[model samples]
Target chain A: MEDFSIIKQQDEILREIEERQPMFTPVQDFSSLEVEYASNPPFQAKIPYLQSKYSGFRRTRGDGNCFYRSFIFSLFEQLIQNKSHLSNPDSPYSQIYSAIKQKVLDSGDILNAAGFLPICYEDFIDMISAKLEMIPTTEISQLEDDFKDKIIADTYVMYTRFIVSAFLRLHADEYSGFVEGYPDIVSFCNSEVDPMNRECEQLQIIAMTEAFQIKAEIEYMDRNDRTETTLMSFPFEYTGPDFKIHMLYRPGHYDILYPNRS
Target chain B: MATRTRLLRELKGKTEEFSLNNVGDDLMIWQAIIQGPSDSPYADGKFTIEFRVPENYPFAPPKARFITRIFHPNVHFDTGDICLDVLKSDWSPAWSLEALCRAIVALLSAPNADSPLNCDAGNMIRAGDMRAYNSMARMYTIEFAQERNLN
Candidate 1:
């Protein structure tokens, strides 16, 4: 009788393990994730190892709370599609990434995509909860969970918005003129002010403008008219109180747009 | 499907001169030419740029660089290192190649003297002396772009 019960218990445990194994399986090939990411350009270059790990997660498990694995896979795909355009060390993407990184002090979403956030968040929550022994308040416990959730939500939203805006802005000039019934490229240029955070407002404007440029580019490309190439040589320029941008574009194996005079 | 669709959109919307090239099964590269902004030192200049996107894009920022040498305080003289905030920690998934190109154009018009990748050039700009800055910039542009007839 005892032996039978032990066997039964073991079988139950095995079944449970089998059921949960898929969720725990690590992500393997991030290359498979290139599709969504390719749709939008990434904010930074990914490390290969990190990319592989993130891809593996997406392959095995669907979506974790952080969705970091999914994000990584998408970003990798975008990089692959745009690799030729990014060959130049001074390309616009590189410059913008450098510029944004320098300005933004904290970007949790980026950290998460790099595969550092999920585990960190878990550990952080664990540590804080452990401190409950000292203060032992139900309110505190509830507050901690709420705070963590808010942070996660904010991070995810901010990251997504930034990526979308950046993509649109980068291609605005190329696609703007071609978008039928779309707002004129010049009309899209407007100052945005944020009362909550002045710097955030500025960043948002920059992002919006960048998105506009990308939209314009995409619209132009869609026309498929040979005449579209005629506009290829037009330079994109930006004038802000703090900075002035003068960019040049050319055609070849890769799109070449560089700062200064290229 | 999403990636292909987006690429198609970008390609169709792009001016005919811009083309996307596949580097590997998982990498795609793009090439484009930009005209110099009017009234700037780079005016009438034709510049080329390259963008490299990895498979794990959007999460990781794409790598970009200038194919031709450029003269600017914010850009590295020898390495073409650019001082831009978005490429680093601030990178958001929303940024695209076109937006980046515009930013580069903007950077040329407004060189960031506050954060100088090229110390000498930055100093000249900060010193409030346009003479030295403009001269060196013009000389560098001529050497890299005009002499080579990149435009």
Candidate 2:
């Protein structure tokens, strides 16, 4: 009887641990996204907005980290597309690495000037920046290896999350001035933006787009609205490049979307 | 994976207040000594924490525990295990080792007894027994943490 009770208690503890784990991994592979759009007609109607902008999108996990994962995936693929546009067929991965290296450095510079403590994220950024430079292979073949390894791909996602977190923390006064209910910076960061696995909302979206200087469009498909999808661009009023990433936000989740130019 | 890089940076960035080094070339196992804040009951205390990083680091949080006994609400007194939210589900890849050490110091200064691992310490705080809690914490620091300061 005693043994049975102890085993039952152990099962309960295991179940709780499993529940605490994320429903999905940091990143997942791409799949045909049309099936997803086709299933929801209301959502399908909004695809034209995306169709005018993007080619296709890769699906990320439903986990809260999807925003970070999907954002990095789109950022790199965009660089790859531009690099490959020359028809050189030579691997664009080297250029992609350089582009990422540049972006992180740029963000780091901005954060540093804003009085953000680099020590908080110095190693996190360095490791990611080093990954691009340290691969030892300036060749495209090495990028193929990077793609196959799940940890490498996920590392990019982790780095992106760090970038956003640092930006939001450093520039709290500039951004959080309008935000309601946070008495101070740490509380605001801790509750709304800093911690891992907290689903990002408007504040995070703005901070990331402004910090990275990447224009982005987030289209919302609501459970209540059957006819129209709300398509709004980020950073409230940043008028920059006409072309940028288009993301599909369906209540609690985000995914990349592309134009079907073909 | 990036733990060593951050540790080195932390060392350079903060010349004092922290002493972090790997036990060996393993890089995965590190010993950290955090200087308690001057204003706290644990002031002048040098607390030792062991950081155990997993193979898939940056993706996972290091398991940090005090090797020195600490009479605090968030720290498990006997095992020295901490109940910091950031060390668990709240961990983000953005946090560096230096950030963690600073957080540990902050934890020592202002412990959150609301959700504590050390029931006795938590209860004392909740019961508004500040005088007793301070004396007890100071005693632990004197016994376990002050020796490093003296040295």
Candidate 3:
């Protein structure tokens, strides 16, 4: 009980910190990371290489759902920036948005198959669809402000987690072998994939990229022997030239990355 | 607001083993009655559980406590807190109170002795004293959770 009380106190402190900090901070220069990691040689060594390829980054709250938050926020930001070409049905942005919208609408079937009752997930899915609908019409600043609303942001993360879990469940035969500790795919999804604030892993990343039909690249900044941060792309076979979302991963946290100036 | 709406919808869904009702029209605080699993020592018992839904319902799990005393490895004898993963770290927004009721009913039958809130009950199961464990649990159910006693 004493241990439990200590944990509860720590959680209160973390929650207080979370309230003071923005859910997603505005774009910050790569030099910010350099200063933050100055004492750590391995991280400092990779900053130059990272800077060469990426201009700036948007910091996400260190909550466990950072990966999903960063990915969705970055994707929506891109779509909003391309709003000029939205009227042109032939434009790549328009095509991508249309395809994603359809996927969101069709996700009900996946959730149903995963044993989720429609009554439970309908509100979450509606919030996700409403936000997606706002992208073309809404300004970038509005998108950031909307995400700052904890309920709205958490609702999106929850739905996205469901999508990831459902995808893994549907393709259990393919992923069951890769799952390490859990007895089977269902239990793995129950504990690891569906829970709020659970960190995402490689399997979840693959599942998200595949289920949403979005390409992503992660710049892994680690304390390894390598001087440069490794760039790993999801959906392994996709050697595509364009990735819809780019993220910087340092240890447990993830943040959105912006491309270098042309 | 969403929590209230979801609870209203869940009130309509039917389940034989458990039923949940609001406490004096308070949507956030619910009262649930769970029938013991037929094969378990707790059979014929009707356990009362109090569920306190946090403001962020579905996102955060509702706090469930066994109001009626029961001898089990996972439920606290004094505080009534049940040591269940779904109520804590494993919670998903996809789960409804109805689902939680079902999970609770399942937990009564398969109490995890490894992570016990009631050490005495847990030790009994761990020591392979099935006869003593069953009888003690059965005695508690009759004393505190029997249908007549619950009323």
Q: What tens digits encode model 1's per-residue C-alpha lDDT throughout B17-130? A: 333344455336875566667767877666677767655444344666677777778776776656665554334434455656777788888888887878898899999987
Off by over 4 Å in 2: A1-56, A84-103, A114-150, A169-171, A178-181, A190-192, B1-14, B36-38, B148-151
lDDT per residue (tens digit) for residues A86-203 in model 3: 6778787887788888989999998999888887888888878998887878999998887888888888788888899999999999999989899999999999989877789899
In candidate 3, which residue pairs clash?
Answer: none
Q: Poorest 10 consecutive residues of model 2 chain A by lDDT?
A: A22-31
TM-score of each: 0.38, 0.75, 0.94
| Local distance difference test, each candidate | 0.43, 0.67, 0.86
lDDT tens readout by residue for model 2, A1-262: 2333554585576457446643233222223334666686666666555555555555555546678766765665555455433233344444444545688777677656644567755655665666544444334344435534656655666566556656777777686675679786556666555555567777777877877667777777765545556789876776544446778788788877765555
The residue pairs found clashing in candidate 2 are A54-A258, A54-A259, A55-A258, A55-A259
Q: Please write out the lDDT profile of model 1 over residues A108-189, one tens digit for every residue.
A: 4433443332322222233322432222233423432432342332333334343333333445676466434437432232
Error of 2 at A235 (Å): 3.6
Better of 1 and 2 by TM-score: 2
TM-score of chain A of each: 0.22, 0.65, 0.93
> Rank order by DockQ, top first?
3, 2, 1
Winning candidate number (lDDT): 3
Weakest lDDT window of 10 consecutive positions for candidate 3 chain A: A235-244
For model 3 chain B, the run of ten residues with the poorest summed lDDT: B10-19
Which whole-number lDDT from 0 to 100 does residue A245 have in model 3?
A: 91
In model 1, which regions exceed 4 Å deviation?
A1-262, B1-8, B16-27
